[model samples]
Each structure stands twice: as structure tokens, then as C-alpha cells.
Target: MLGPDGIKDIAKMDPREGAALLEAHIENFDGEAAMTMWLQTKPKILYKGGARSRFAAAFHPRENKFEVEVLFSKAPTDFHPTCNQIFYFGEELELALKYAWWAENRVPAEAACVLQVALPASKMSEGVYVDDAKRWERLVWHSRRVDSHGQPLEAAPDTVVSLLNERILVGPICGMSPHVVQGLPRGGWQRLTKIRLSNNQNATQVVFMNPRTFVERCEEILWVLSSVSWRGNSSQDLLVMHGLRVQPLNVGQIAAS
Candidate 1:
């Protein structure tokens, strides 16, 4: 995948030379600058040793208003489909595909396949949902992971945002959701869908965002996710750079997936 090294190569060139490339490529360029965002969430285990999903968002910068979904189709981190997905949101096409590729790589080949070919396939839907104000974006997703289901391992508040800018004042575990008038609004527990993994069809469903944000345009997601994928019992770490090669993402940047 085209990575940080590739991003700098474009900036090192003469402004006029790079500008020509940007003009024909980057749709969101401003003056001599171009911006993109990357959003990420790592896989978390709920049932101790069974099911897992990359539901954590590791923050980094890229662009804005992007959508993504990685399939755990084959089991663990398996190969991804080479097709770029068309989605309900996001402005960049190439960036989305690159992000999905990185996600597929993060998963183990077995679980990844189960997530795709088992869980969601058993209970077909347009896709998973998170009741909120965000319009689900499906523009770029390609995972080959698979999963079967049970009550997802319960998650606490901390699992929502790993690096919250400020600590949330959550203490009362006994109060009802709509408890106060305007403290944090009345939201129930996180929306969890119990997907049944099967040995039959290939279960698959793309993930969506509730509210898209800056530096989350898709390409950046590749970097942040690759970083998170290094978590394990091992002492050493591995680095994998994700890249895209589409019409818009293929401009002045030099990289591949």
C-alpha cells in the first residue's frame, strides 16, 4: 500500500509540477494543499475466546466524511476482493478501497472469513446499523473475513473511544437512559446485532459511521488500522502500509496495495 513515504514524495516536487497532478486528480485541493483523513477501530473480543470485531476507533488524520467496512470472511486476515465498493457517502473513491484493504489485513484469515461468510449471511440485511444521525456510507468496503454469532461479548464505556479528548463523567450505573434533561442526552446501550455464524452461505455486511468526521476519508484508515493490528501476545511488532490505486487517489501520490 502507498504509505507515509508516498505522501511526502508528492510534496517534494515543484509546486507547478505537483499542482498539475492535483488539478486533474484531487477534488478537494485548496491552493497548493490537499488533505485526507483516516479513521480506525481495532478488533475487540467479547466472549473471551470466541467472537471478535474491530470496533475501536484509533484516531489519525486524513480527510472527512468517509465510510468503511472490512469483512472477516476467510478466517483471520485473508485476501480482499479487488473491486472498489460504491457507497452511500464519502467524496473519494480510491481512498475508500485502500482503507478496506488494510482492515482485511488486520484480521486473521479464519475469523475474517467467518465474519463475512457466516455471521451476517445467516441473517441478511442491507447492512449493520447504529441508530444515529449519520448516513451510512458504503462507498468502499472489501473484506474476506467470516464469523458466526452469539451475544457479542459485553463492552463497557471505555471501549467506545480509546482516546477521548476528555474523560466522560459516568458514575451512576443504576439510572435509566433518559435520566436527565440535557446532561448527555438519552441514549441506550450500544447497538449490538447478534449475527449467527453458519457453515453454509458467506455472511457479509459492511460497517457504517454514525457521524463522519475530519481525517476520516478512508486512506488514513489504512495507516491507523495497520498500527492497531500489531496487538497480541508477541513482543515484536510488524508494520504494513496501505495504498490505493484509483482514478482520484492515483494522482501525484506514489503507492499501492
Candidate 2:
């Protein structure tokens, strides 16, 4: 979420794109307003990660499995402490979708766009702990069977659990709901325009334009993208998506030591 200051910096850096995009924005309002409109309706990025990181996954429904091996950027320093557990290979997709749905619900109908989000590097799951504990496996079972407070997992009116009894105890299916699949870092379930590599690294930013893509990634880490900068290492700028009105856990919010 670029504040007045952040947006101003963009205007300074890339006047061409900034002015062009801003011109479109101003024209949309019949040129009646000034900078306020741009500030209020900031572009919500679908996702922003490095070319090498795992931004998207190819899901083969026929095979009932997906493949994503690209390493992701680490969680931000500020966000690391808030994360309770890192996700595994499959869990990341499901969690991201759930978070996207949650965020979409909170957005006001009149609001030009959903709130811009920001994430740190530390929050993302490091796949799984590389040890004998098999913590990732255990966590998956626990998440399916119990709530954060250790209570039984409950199903809403028409939740995934309600529709399939198997999902209650078992983890999500390889070919889960489209909602989850759409959250892939590369974009939604279907490939839109193929993004080609260009001299400008920012060109590939669209790979994550699908709102769901950001949602799932963010949910895994429990962070909301606040703002994005196309300035330096684009990979470092890449952050995760967030759950709906879900307030991210913060150090200040936790009980004092």
C-alpha cells in the first residue's frame, strides 16, 4: 500500500509509466479530481516474486497432483516471529485460497479496489522442517482436526468440510476446488496471456495478477501486502497475500513476556 510518499517516489522514478497510468486514472474521473483519486485507488498487485522463486504451480488434474519446486524468497524479518508454522508442498495452495476469499469478503463494494497489502520474507513456509520430527505432517493433521485453540474443527453452512466428509480428517485433494488452485503464484487456474521475459523485469509482474494467487500465498504466511516497489530486486519486493478482515498476528498483539 503506497502512501502519498511512496507513490510520489514512483512518479519521480518512472515518469512515463507513472504519468501514463495516472493519466488513465485521471481520465477515468473525467479529469475532475487531482492526486487524491490515485492515492485512494491504488493498484492491488496479484503477486510479486523473483523469477527464480516459486510463484506459480502447474496442476495436472488428470494426474491428481501439482508440481512447484521453485524456491521462494524468505519471509521478512518483521514477519518471521508472527508465523506459527510453515506450510508444506500442498498446504500452501489451500491456505492461500482461503485467505483470498476471506480478504475479498471484507472489501467494500464501493471501494475502487481491495486494500493494498504488504508482506515480509520471514512469514513464508520453508517447505517443511528438515528433521525427524515430521512436523509438517503432524501440523497438517492437526489443522484438519482441530482449531487454533485445540477445539474440534467446525464446518460452516457450505464449507469444504460440509461438502466432503473426507476433507474433515484428510488434507485437501490433489485436485482441490478451483478457488484453491486459482491461488497459484503464477495466476489463476487457467493461463491467460503468456507472460514473456523482457529486459524490464517488471514486465513479469503480471504473472501473479490473479487475485487468488496472492491470497493463497499470503494465507500461508498470514501477512497482507501493503505496497509494492518496482525499484530494486523485484524478488525481494515480492510478498505474500492475506486473509480477509483477518488481522495478521503481530509482536505487539501477542501477550507480553
Candidate number of the best TM-score: 2
Q: Which 10 consecutive positions of candidate 2 have the poorest summed lDDT?
A: 73-82
List, in order, the clash count of every candidate structure: 65, 21
Cα lDDT, model 2, residue 44: 28
> Cα RMSDs of all predictions?
18.7, 18.9
145-213 per-residue lDDT for model 2 (tens digits): 333454423332232222222211212212233233223443122322211222311121111211223
* Model 2 score (lDDT): 0.25
Candidate 2 has a TM-score of 0.21
TM-score of candidate 1 versus the correct structure, residues matched by position = 0.20
Name model 1 segments beyond 4 Å from true: 1-8, 24-147, 157-211, 214-257
In candidate 1, what are the lDDT values of residues 33-68, reduced to their tens digit? 322211012111111011124422212124322223
Candidate models: Cα lDDT each: 0.23, 0.25
